[model samples]
Target: MTNFLVSSFSLSAAPRNSVSRIQQELTIAQKQVATGRFADVGEALGVTVGRTISMRAEMSNIEKLKGANTSIAQRFDTMQAVLETAAGSGENLMSSIISNGSTDEGIATNRRLALANIGQLVGVLNSSYGSRYLFGGGKTDTVPMKSDIVNDYATSQASGTVDTAWQTFVTANAGGDPSLVTADQMKSFLDNEFAALFVTGNTDPALNTWDLHWSNASSSQTQARIGESDLITTSASANDDGFRNMMKSYAMLANLSGESLSDEARQVLTSRSVETLSTGLSQVTDLRSEIGIGQERISRANDGLKAQTFILKVAIGKEEEVDSYEAAIRVTNLTNNLEASYALTARISRLSILNYL
Candidate 1:
């Protein structure tokens, strides 16, 4: 008789291997049901796994940009507040001059006001946000002005280039008594010598008062990256024309207030101060508008990033997330299959000559 023979070792090994395979499948299904995602993402996604990885990376980048944008927006807000306060101080100075007239008492009072405003301006420009000076441009760690503008003006008046220049102007014009100089002569000095000191591009040590004594701010502004390709200015410089001009106007009033000048000279000086202040106010307004534009651009960038994040999340979910209800059903089936496998393994283990007894 022809009979097929199978080894007892083969029978036992097949059943044991089947039980092991079923146990592994049950574990995977149980994990999927518990987590609502594929237990083996790379295995299930196969060659398409790269797409999910790319989407996840993009989402991470967008989140990082959004976080940075929050700080940029805050910096812009601080700058706006500072500029607004400076503008208000300018207005108050203008009002003080206009209402106080040109009498000796008025001049004294106005000098006090100008000095106070100078202090305020210096403090605002040196304003710091979390250890960084806001108006220092790219040199955020440095204080923009080493001292108050008044102190620098006083130093120049006492024993510096400004004092030397003033004496030279008086000598050349044969105008007796520096304090009693005529209006026309004072105008010429202001137009030629004093105004030159505050010009933004002037690098002459004898003329550029701002660079020599007043400011330590960098000309290069600070910037921030709010998006993948978007960059915007995030700081203002104390070395700008607006700030310099304002300081110059205040210096003229404060320095001349304590002097014994002719009525005509005082009138000319007051008129020039008013004109200079007006120009500085206009420039300060422009700076405020620039910060506003940056804020708007940051808002737009944040909106775009938020939208991109939403889209990427949807794509990632489709690739990695599993239906919980379906996974639960699979878990039940896998459990029953594992139990049947174990039963067959037990039956095979019992098949021996001793069972036949």
Candidate 2:
């Protein structure tokens, strides 16, 4: 009587539900086998899921830092190349000054050379990396130096403040001829007037010349974070004493080339230009060293980050990783269970009261 009361709906529904559940478990096991990780990490890890999340977050951060380090290393390399070019230009100018810059012919030749070097130096200082001006300090979006500064100075040499100052010196000394000007007088003009033109932050309109003509760089240097707590200077400024001194050397030569000078005055100019250029070149070398040091620190930081990345991966593996062998065995068991359930469902569906009789 109890067997006669069995319902057809209950017989089919039980095996149908069993097949559906086994299919779902098989799908999960197959996924775990393929990925070698938990199919439901949160479900499996429970409260320990937080540790897995934290480790994955740290891994993501390390990857981002590694990418940043790569970009910073490239920027440092570009800066090194530009500094090398600037140093070469300075050396060429120093050689010209030391060799034969005092004679009229030599002055003309050296003036042309200095002009060329000025263009080259300006081009390098105004150099860019991915739309950012490398020498602009924090003002990376702006051009660091005037591209036409050399040309502008050349065009205005006769009409600008430099000529005005020279005219005043001539009037004071009561001399119409530049050849009649003494070395000490030329020294005063060079040290006082010409030097003023290149000086930064002079309130006087005549002396505030560098800002007006040449440099647009910020006084602040560019800095970058290579690590969580490590910040380093990443760029050189066009307004640095090194760059300004270099410009001073080139400007003095180019502007003075047209004037007829006494041998003593020319000698004084050449000597001073040589000293300025040598100092500038030395400072350029120092800047290169600074960039090199930053590069070294980045290299060391990356090594440490890589080590941490490896450690974090191992730690995460302990919590989220699944054994592929075990997962494959589970998949096989689930597949067999699903097939048996499917057969049972088919048998239950074919059941009839007349067949049982």
Candidate 3:
């Protein structure tokens, strides 16, 4: 009968509450670490490493494209300057030929000298940028003028006469003589033939007959086209009337060997030379303008690419970067909650049913 009055005592909820709070803090810390928001040491280390890797790749691509754009622009600029010089030289030579009558032996000498200048101009037409021939059309490895001397001319040897020889040269080598071939022909027999040769029927957009070419191997095919014209339909049987007219004019001038020719013949030949040169200049100018247009297009495309690359970088940054202020606040709050939880848990453990009794 000495049984103590049975009293049921329940433990206070502080211990459970403290455990729950501590668990919640741990969850928050885990989430922050995983999402890269809070500055948990492990999470911060991981985020920094990943972000550095992503940013390096993005930056590298941007830099590479930028360099390519610069190279393309510089090449176009150089081509423009060269064309300008060629045009000026042509004008000066034409003026000299027109003003000084061929009756003067000096006129023939001057003509030969001018022919040399034209040969120089042809050399310019065969200019290159990094291994690419600028004027060989799609054949970027071969020069546009193989020889500037008429005697060394390929077509002249084949045809035996200047008129027939050049026609043969153009037809056989250039696929067909261009309508504007008069000005492009060799000035002397010692000069090499002027013809555009390309890999047969190869119509790659970047490859034109005026461009240089090497082996058909993939490694050697990185050349670019520089000249403006590449006829889609080339025919030897069909007459290049424009080219024929130009050659006729050149032949007329070439035949005037001595000062004894009639005044009318001299006048006609001089007039023809002036006219042919003028026509040739027009063709060259037109081609140059076309090149300018191509250059503008490439520049615009490069600018657009740059803008897009910048936007991509911004997007990448948003996805990977952490806000330091937000991370710091979360870390502080988590630290405080964990400390409070621990204190509350200790206090609860001491308040058992026996302690209360």
Candidate 4:
């Protein structure tokens, strides 16, 4: 019989080594597959996480912008309501003036009330949003009207008795043809004319001077218009449209006080009031309409932002989240690979020189 020498045996280590290497590779591949990221850990971990965080931040910003848009829309709606009230009050005042005329005490009372309403409107014009006034025309904090009382009438009215101090101005500048003055020249003339009228120690001592008193006894130095018509002649000339109309209206009211006005005169005054009120109302309506359009645009922009945020959220999820089915599948594959590796390692352990002997 051949000498049967049962030497100590061991399994070939190659199979065990191959199984361990395969298991390590499968672990790495499983991590990549489960995370739905690139297989290279050196590059994908930081880049993918940073990308997801950035996308989340972008989505948060879009949501915040949508909230801001909503707030602005609400503000616009409130402004529209206020403007509507103002327009309605204006219309009511105009109708009353047209129907009652100057003979009616109610008309005068209503006119006074309308003036008060205009004061209220001025306050609304100075309404603010975040420290910015709405109607200040870019000078947000500045009030447009001074509302101080000054002797506007006696100082501004052209005088025939005192050689018309403005005559010197005309002679010095326009050769006595006041109509030759342009709009800017007229504005400059009116500004200086008002200063001369109100300021003490005038260059022309012969010019007529007047002291101004307030409508209310409590308020000192308040210059009230003589009448609705005085608004025009109170200045050297009717220069500004708003100031001119205001003076003319006041002069008309003054002329009608305590006197019976002719129907024709009443009709003219009523027409003028309506025209002015209508023009102001049209401007207010146009502005409100523009705000409404802006509100709509803001709403649309918010919707777009929300949609974009949703898309970004989806993108972020795609970049970072593990797909459940895919991850489970990879885990199952890894488990099977691990079991095979253990079986191969066991078989290799069993294979030894003693078994061959």
Candidate 5:
């Protein structure tokens, strides 16, 4: 009597509604199994949403940091290759200078190599990567050293400022006979005439028309933060001590080509060239060491970031992802429940008042 008033519509609709709900749950479980994440991430994370979001943000930042480190690594590696060539050339120049540059036997050949070395140094200084000059300091678009300066520097041996100064000093002290010029006088000429060109930036209009290749670019070295609080220099400019010394050495080698090949001349040239080139070698070695340290630090930081990213990823997975094995089991149970509900609804719809009587 209590169920005598049950609506036939209700009897038919109840099982269908139940089956639909179970089918919906089954669909969500299937999605979770397929995608490895909860269908409703916000619902799954519940109170842990804050931690999951924070971890994901950190992971994103770590990826950006890795990208920056990769860029720095490429620059440093290219710089290392350049310095290797420059350092080798400087060392060889010292040895050649020590032997008086082979005493006119291979003078022409040595001159060619020396000139080529000048060009190579200028090329290296003007090296670039994607619009950024490796040695330009803050002037990324500018060539760090002018190749024309090499010619001017080499030609200075004959009639440039240093040559004029050399003539004046010799005329004043030794009646313009360079052979009669003392070692002291030669040293004085170098100190007074050429040292400024090496140690100080050339401001003479006739020397630098390009207005590039400043000698005090250390202050303009570019910096980047590979970490939250770590800032490091990423550029080595032409103003570096090694490049300055090497430039002077190369220039002196060129100048010597225009001088007398006598023992006295040789000794003076060798003395100056060897001393400066040796200093340059040492400086280049130190710079190499410094950069090596920087590269190692960057590498370690990069590894740390990757490890952190992995940890964050694992954390986020646990917080926002579904267990595929458990979801699969849930899918099976829900499918069976849906099938049973569908069959029960069909059977109930088939029932009639005569069968109950």
Candidate 6:
């Protein structure tokens, strides 16, 4: 008791829509085969979109960290080379003084060589990388030590503030011999005018390079991000006790070079001078050792960063990469479906009103 009415136009339109959908699927599969990565990452990763995005971002950050770490490591290497060479020169100067019976000319000549070596060391300390001074701390644009440090020292020591005090103490109390200056007098001079040159950090406006007005001692150092969870620091300046003691010894030895004193005075000066220079050598040696330790830490951090990068790459690849074999199979199936759709459409289009009747 039911009458069925079906329009040919409606029937044709429904098949056409199904054929269009099959063609669209075929196009997507072909694109997946051509590009190893999904054409639509969000559509391909449906529920895992957030996680894939995070992993990719982290991998990008790790790449940037690796680049920065390479630069820090280079600075560390240069630091070690300069420190070792300076320490060696200090040690050599002390050794020559200890085993010398040469004339004042010989001593003076040695002092001249030492002065040049000290100046070279200062240049290394102020070395720059890409317009930024290595030892300048937060003031990378500024030189950390005065260019005329040796000259300033000569002026200060000769003005009776340091040399005169030592000379006066030795003359009055040291048996009329300048070389016989006692440790008390030496320490006193160092505590007063001597330490004034370097101690408590050079905050004087007159001495801009030696100024210690940094946010913090460590702030003067370079902090590098080697990994997601790691930071490495390295820095050194003329104010470091190692450099201070070494430069002080050099200055004093240089001053003694110009003095017209007896062999007894020279010998006395030489022995006492040898002692201080030896201590400076020890401090510089320790700084070189610290550089070795810093290099080791950076090496370890680099390894960790590499491992993290690999893990992130693997995770991201799984979410975004197209499976070549699977994609090929899907392409074949879609092609067949499209061909069948075309055949059906042709057959339907061929069926006119007369054929239907």
TM-score of each: 0.81, 0.87, 0.51, 0.50, 0.82, 0.72
In order of TM-score, best first, we have: 2, 5, 1, 6, 3, 4
Cα lDDT tens digits, model 1, 64-154, are: 9999899888888888888889899999999989999898788898888887777888888999886888999899999988654435445
Candidate 4 residues lying further than 4 Å off, grouped into runs, are 1-44, 143-263, 324-357
Clashes of each: 0, 0, 33, 20, 0, 0
Residue 129's C-alpha lDDT in candidate 3? 78
Clashes of 2: 0
Please give, for residues 188-221, the per-residue lDDT of candidate 5 as tens digits. 7777666755544445645641233333233377
User: Residue 84 of model 1: what lDDT?
Assistant: 89
At residue 90, what lDDT does model 1 achieve?
93
- Over 96-165, each residue of candidate 4 has an lDDT whose tens digit, in order, gives 7667765677657655655455455444544556564444443445443333422232233322211254
- What's model 1's overall lDDT? 0.82
For each candidate, what is the lDDT? 0.82, 0.82, 0.50, 0.50, 0.73, 0.68
CA RMSD, predictions in order: 4.1, 3.0, 12.5, 15.3, 4.2, 6.0
Using TM-score as the measure, name the better of candidate 3 and candidate 5: 5
Model 3 poorest ten-residue lDDT run: 230-239
State which candidate has the highest lDDT: 1
Supply the global lDDT for candidate 4: 0.50
Model 5 off-target regions past 4 Å?
A: 1-12, 99-102, 150-177, 201-218, 341-357
State the weakest 10-residue window (summed lDDT) of model 4.
230-239
Q: List the residue pairs that clash in candidate 5.
A: none
User: What's the true lDDT of residue 199 in model 3?
Assistant: 22
Question: lDDT score, residue 51, model 3?
Answer: 65
Residue-level lDDT tens digits of model 6 in 1-357: 999987777767877898889888878888889987797999878988999988888888888887887887888788787777788788778777666544766787667766765676666667777677766666667776654442443443222344655565557666666555554555554455455544434455544222432111223566667776676666665556776677667766675556655555555556666766788778878877877888888889889989998998788888888999999999898888878878887777777778757
lDDT of residue 344 for candidate 4: 75
Which parts of model 3 are misplaced by more than 4 Å?
A: 1-65, 148-160, 163-260, 324-357
